[model samples]
Every structure is written in structure tokens, then in C-alpha cells.
Target: MRIIILFLFFIAVGVGAFSQTPKKKVGADNRAVPTKNKIQSQMNEATSGIAKEIADLEEQLKTETDEETIKNLKEQIGMLKKQLKMMQGLNKNVSNMSNKVIQQAFNSETSEIPKRDVNRINSLPKKILNDGELFVFMKQTTQEVENKLAIEGKKLGMQLFDTLKARKYSAQAMGQYAFACMAGGFPEMGLYIYGKACLADMNNADNLNNYAAYLTMAGGEQYSIPILDNLNSKYPFNSTILNNLGQAWFGLGDMNKAKKNLEDAVRIYSIHSRANETLCLIQQSEGQTQQATES
Candidate 1:
């Protein structure tokens, strides 16, 4: 009895917090949100239909018992059950998505961030970073379609840039936007976004490190000379930075430098997975495979 009372109290507090918390906006760049009730109704209807079909099949199976017919009816019943469960889950997900969209809309209307300008995507001025509204609006949509819309990655990146530009442009925004573009499956566009981000703020160590890391991963030796010098200069002996620097040299076929940098990084952060992996790689390249073998 006491435990139940405590649970009820906790639930009441949770409800109060949610009721007081303000909602977020979907952004000036909105996606279509299906109504929760409609989705739920569809879910119920689908479930009913499937249940009715299964009942009919069961009834038929009882009367007409050919061995092969019974087997097929059992299989169909199993398939229909799975479909019904899936539809119900989808309906619940739809309702959740609707709430998120609605909250985002509310937050946007209350916040000072400018709405995204859906007009021209390519010609956005560099002054867009002054406002913080664009990412707020477009990030969700970009995530929603990016992997599925890999072919349209360039278009999405361009659109995102212009949307962000309508707010303000900064290394932070550019870096994040570029990274997002890359994540969305447009490697080249991601590189371009990183370029814009780096150009906007050369003093940003993280931006340089990450952008170079991306280049190192993509172009291997071809990109070593480009970002290594700058990264090494900026972050002297930082562990993760050193690890990446080691990787950059490794890609450029400088096995000695790779081994050296990776060793230094491991010395600083002994348990770093990537540093260990890099060390293992270096060992393999030097025919020290047995020594580097994972236990």
C-alpha cells in the first residue's frame, strides 16, 4: 500500500513538470505531421481487419482439414498477427512524432530565432550565423530524410546552409552543418561544409581536428599534408589529437611517425581504443604482428 502511494506521488510530480514545461517549434522549415487520432484509428482498424481475417481462417481450418490447408492457414495466421502488432506500434510512433512536431512549433513561435526562409537556398549571405533559428527548424527534417535521400544530399546541404544563413553563420554552425551533411551521405558536400566552417574560424581547434580527421579517413595519404601541419601546430601533444595525427601520418605511409605519435597518445591515455588500434596497425605494418595481436 505504501509503495503504491509513493508511485502515485511520483507520477503526479512527473505530470506537473510536463505541464509546466514549454513546447519546442518544428521550425520555419516544417514537415508534415499526421494527426495522432487518425493514425491510432487506422491502427485499430487494421488490427480489427487482421483479427477478423484470422478468425475466418480459423473457422475454415476447423471445418476443412486437408493437411496442406491446415499448414497454410497456420502460417497465414502467424503473418497476420505480426502485421497487426507492427501497425499498432506504428500508430503509437505517429502520435509521438506529432507531439514532438507540435512542441517544436510552439518553441519556435516563442523564441527570437528567425524563421527559415524557404526561398533561395544557394545564394544565402554569409551573415546568417547571427541568428540561432535555422538549425532549430531544419535539423529534424534533415535527419528524417538524409539516409533515405542520399542522392539528394547536395540539395539538402545547400538548403540547410541557406536556412542557417538566414539566421547567422559561424564556425560552430558551419562545422555542425557540414558534419550533418556528411552524416547524411554527401561526403563531398560534408567536406565543403567543413571548409566553410574552417574558413569562418581558423582558430577553432576542434573544427580543424575533425575536418582533417574526415579528410584523413576519406583520402588517406592524399590529405595528410593538407591538415596535419595545422593540426599538429594547434594541438601540440593532446592525446586524441595525437592519435589522429598519428593516423594522418600512417595514411601518408610514414610508418615511423605513425608509430611514434600513436605511442605518445597511448602513453597519455593508456586505454584509448583508437590509439590501441593504431598501435596494433603500426605493429602489423612493421611485421610485429605477433606482438600486437589482441589477447
Candidate 2:
């Protein structure tokens, strides 16, 4: 009788311990529910229609081999990268990655990242897009379909202009609008828009760089030279700005300054192809034909 009573007591103790474990589990479960739901919601938002399409395009970039198609795809990818960066509450600084690095990151043979990391991409509250956001979206859509799908890029540009008339243009929006204008084959209008953008955000390094580049491309370096000089004074180490300054000086018939800036650009970013090309052209012009060819 004593042995049986001891066994019964032990059994009751074990049952009590087991029963108490449920309360602990229930508390933990309740705590986890909110977290679990939050994560799922984030995943859903990150994989929403537009975000998912961007991911799919990124994946397609991995296998794409045609040069023209690759160029177009990279442009799309760049915009998507910016969108992702904006959504993550990070600074929307334009990316200046080399094509090699970009290709490596999204390359089929070497991709290590998921299609899109929901944890990284999700968190933004939905609201009406500001001018900058809407402009960038329209620009990306214009580029994606403008030439490839029988859609006119110029028409998109007109639509962008109409939209901009109703709202004050942000610096970024103006810059993007200029690009859209260029794409639409309105060079003079593009230059005008770029000029406005630069005036609106003269202190922005990006705006300065972009504006100078556009001026150099248009052979209006007389205007670009001062802007580039100002930018160089501020960001001496920026290779793109340096290259553009070189191009501007070259357009202005100032070979010495052009050579100096181009050389400096190459020194900073050894693989700066445009700088190398300009340097080679300068060498050829100066009768250093051997050096030009070798470079």
C-alpha cells in the first residue's frame, strides 16, 4: 500500500508539471502571433505586383546576353534599385556602380541574394506619391516600353509635362523630366528642363554633375565649365564629375585642362572608359600617336 501511494504521488506531480507547461506555451504563442503576422504582411507588401515585377526583371537580367537588351534592362534595374532604396527608408542617392559590379551582383552564375528580401524591402506606409515618386515611376515605365513595345517615348514625355504643370517640380523630377525630354527627341527642351533643375537645386552634387554632363554632351560646355568647376571644388574625388569636366574643357578647346581632368579621372577610377577614350583622343591630337593607340 505504501509503494502504490508513492507511485501515485509521483504520477500526480508529473501531471501537474505537464499541465503548467501549457500556460507557458500559451503565453509564448500569444507573443509570437503579432510578430508572425507582421512578418507575413511585410512579405506580402514586398512581393506586391510592382515590386514582384521588378524582382522578375532583375532575375531576367541574369540570363540576358544581348547588348542592347542588356542596356535597356540595366536602366530598368537601376530605377528599380532606386525604388527599393526609397522604400527601405534609405537615402535615394543615385547608384554609380560599374557595369561589371552590377552584372556580377545579378548574374545567374553568382547570385546570392533572394529575388527580393522582404525584410529589407518592406516598411513604407502607403500614401499618395509626391511629384518625385510619380515622375520616376512614369520615367521608368516610359523607358521600359517606349521603344520596345511600339509606345512613343515622346507621348510619355508630353504626359509627364502635363502632370508637372499641376505641381511644383522637385529637383529630381526636373532632372528626370529632362531625361524624358531627351528620350523623346527634344534636345532643346531637355536642355531647358535641365537648366531649370540645376537652378532649383544648385547645391545638390547630383544635380550639378547631371547638369554638367548634359551640357558637355550638347557641346554647350561654355555653360557647363563653370558648373563643373564649382562641383569639382566641392567634390574633387568624384570621377564622373571629373570626366564630365574633362569633356567640357575639351569642348571649349582647352586641351591642357581637359587632359589634366581626364588623367585625374582615370587615376581615381582606373576603369573609367570615357576618360580613357578622351585621353586617347587628346594624345592623338597632340601627335603622341603611339601613346594614343596603346591607351
Candidate 3:
């Protein structure tokens, strides 16, 4: 699934005509700061658990007489082994780096998006708007307006921008605005707005997930990986997060890691279309015709 998963930001417009604006570097002052020791400990424990599970499954395979059961056990063991390897690699990487170094690396990677300018908005006190309100506003303003040529559309865009700067919108609202910008043919602005949204609310899982997705779509998979990894640590069973992480690894040409995460995602949620499709593609690429067809 190399296609962009525009979950709710689908807009019928010619996005190709517009040249992407130069990215403005933004600081990572509000990013979800990871604790090196804690994450390492968690990964170590998870690796141990996976290793033990693999051992148990291998033992079961040894004693099982039913061919079907044996096949399932072997498959489980193989998946577990891959997971073990991934965890060990992650632990090694995390253990070798200091928290400051990790943070610096992340900041450097995500410096393309522009920082929010607090001074652009009005100074008067106003009620903070939510995502729903912002979305309605976006819909109303974008109706029948072509941002690139139409004067009305340009005015609307400025109105939207000014409104965003006018007050400290909620994180969810910022996320919505980011989507609107992207769907409405403003990729650079969308990225910038979403970057600030992620910074403002790093704890929100949806916010982080969407941000990573945007980065991956924009050929910034290297930057998305860290965020996806952190999100994975917090929500190990989230299929969407695992799928996104797998896509990022695939984008970086790490087939093993990509396969591992995609497999985990599909195993957790068999109905995940993107994960299943990607896994199938990997199998086809490797000449595993039977496996690919089955997938």
C-alpha cells in the first residue's frame, strides 16, 4: 500500500499544479520526550517475553502430531522470532544513545515544518475553537473556491490562516486544519500546521499517528519512524500504528523490519487492508507466490 491513506481529508482538486513551498524549520519544543531508560527497560522485558513465547511454541510443535496444528505453531514461532530480533535491535540502538542525543536526532529530522508564529494572531481574549467548529469553517470557506486562481479562494485561505493565528486552537482543531490544508491543495502549509499540532499535543495518539502518516507520504519516512516507534511502545497492539511503522521501514528499504511490523499488524487485525496488501506485495517481491496469493 504505497498510496496515501487520506482517511478523512479527501478533496477533489488538482494538487499537482501547485509547487510545494520551501519548508520552514521548526523547533521540537513540545514533542513527546521519551525517557531513554524506561523505553529500554520496556523493550528488554518485551523481548524476553517474546523469546519465551517462541520457545513454548517450538516445544508445542515438537510434540504436535496434527499437521495443521504443527503448521500454525511453526508460523507463530517464526513471527515471534522476528519480533525478538526487532526488539533486540531496538534495545541495542536505544541503549547506545543518550536521551539528549536521541532528542537532538529527532529534532534535526523533523526541522522541515514551520514553527507557529504567535504574533500573527489577534491579542484579544476569545473562546478556543474545537475540531468540529474548525472543520465546519473549513468546509464553508472552501466551497466552490479554487485556491490557486480564484480571488475568493485566496481570500478564504487568508481568512482561515488569520483565524488560526487569532487564537490558540486546540490540538484536535489544529489537526483538522492541517488536513484541510492538505486536501485543499496546500501541502506545505498542511505539513507546517500539523507539525505544530503534533508539538502541542504529543500525548494524543491520533495526532502523532496522523503526523507520522503525513511525513511518510511526503518522503520523510526517516523522521516518521521515531515517532511511530514511540507510539508503538505506548500502544503495542494498535494495528494502525504498526501498519504505519511498517510502511516507514519499507520506505527506508528495511524489508525485514517492514515485514515484521506488517506481519504483526495483520496478525493483530486481519482486516487491515493496507497491511495485508503490503505484506502480499513483499511476498510477491520475494517470489513467494503461494504466500503472496494466500495473503
**Against the true structure, whose lDDT is highest?**
3
**Residue-level lDDT for 175 in candidate 2:** 63
The per-model lDDT (C-alpha) reads 0.48, 0.48, 0.54
Give the TM-score of each candidate.
Answer: 0.45, 0.46, 0.48
lDDT tens digits by residue: candidate 3, 153-181: 34434444444555556876666666544
Candidate 2 lDDT, tens digit per residue, 37-57? 332233234324225546766
- RMSD (Å) of each candidate, 1 decimal: 22.0, 26.4, 23.5
Quote the lDDT for 239 in model 3: 61
Per-residue error (Å), model 3, residue 50? 48
**Poorly placed runs, candidate 2 (over 4 Å):** 1-165
Better of 2 and 3 by TM-score: 3
Off by over 4 Å in 1: 1-156, 289-295
